[model samples]
Target: MSFLRSLSPLRAWRDLRRFLALRKPHEIGFMVISFAVTGTILFALYKDAAIPPTYKRDVLYVESWPLSRTDREIIDQQKADLIAEKKRAAELRARQLKRQAEFKRLDDRLERLGI
Candidate 1:
């Protein structure tokens, strides 16, 4: 798109520089330290030498994204609870329909008696 093409890399860099210039010295130092730490962690994660050949990269990456064996167990338990809840809901719905039918029968009897 023409709009996307209009975005200049130099302009973005200049904007970023201006934004950084507005920050206090302590804030800038904190930002730099955080960036360094994050970059180091990412570099370590993706660097081929840091990974063992036996482990697939996808498995290694997925293992770190906040879900482990205990989490899986919890998820499975929740799914089971959900299924039980659905079954209970269906039972309640059937009871409700039966009650509604009984009420309609009573209403029809009252109409026939002119009450």
Candidate 2:
């Protein structure tokens, strides 16, 4: 069929050679510019039309308690959670401070060594 024949690399190469041999430089430049502009427009349109991805990363997972739990239990759980969060934050701050101190010491030693 015509479609299969058009798919031949040899035929396509010959056509390209023929076009280059026959066309003016300005004609080729215009064709190249036209193709580039048309391609960019089509790509933009395709991107806009395509469906976006749904991400589970946007959903924040939180702890769920039983509906049968009393108000006092809920309050206690909240307090415990807050305490745990604070402890974690404190630990992170301590780690960061320790790292900063170590880096400062290393910098001082390096400076003494003229490095």
Task: Look at candidate 1 and give me any clashing residue pairs.
Answer: none
Per-prediction TM-score to the true structure, in the order listed: 0.40, 0.41
Cα lDDT over the full model 1: 0.85
> For residues 1-115, could you state the per-residue lDDT of candidate 1 as single tens digits?
9999989999999999999989999999999999999999888878957666542353323333335558778789789979988997898789889989999999999999999
Highest TM-score: which candidate?
2
Q: Cα RMSD (Å) per model?
A: 25.2, 12.0
User: Which ranges in model 2 have alpha carbons more than 4 Å from their true place?
Assistant: 1-64
Worst 10 residues of 2 by lDDT: 51-60
Q: Mind giving the per-residue lDDT tens digits that candidate 2 earns over 1-115?
A: 9878769888889998997989899999999999999999999999988967533344557877788999999899889989988997898789889989999999999999999
Model 2 score (lDDT):
0.88
What's model 2's TM-score? 0.41
Question: Candidate 1 — which residues are off by over 4 angstroms?
Answer: 48-115
Give the best candidate by lDDT. Answer: 2
Error of 2 at 111 (Å): 1.9
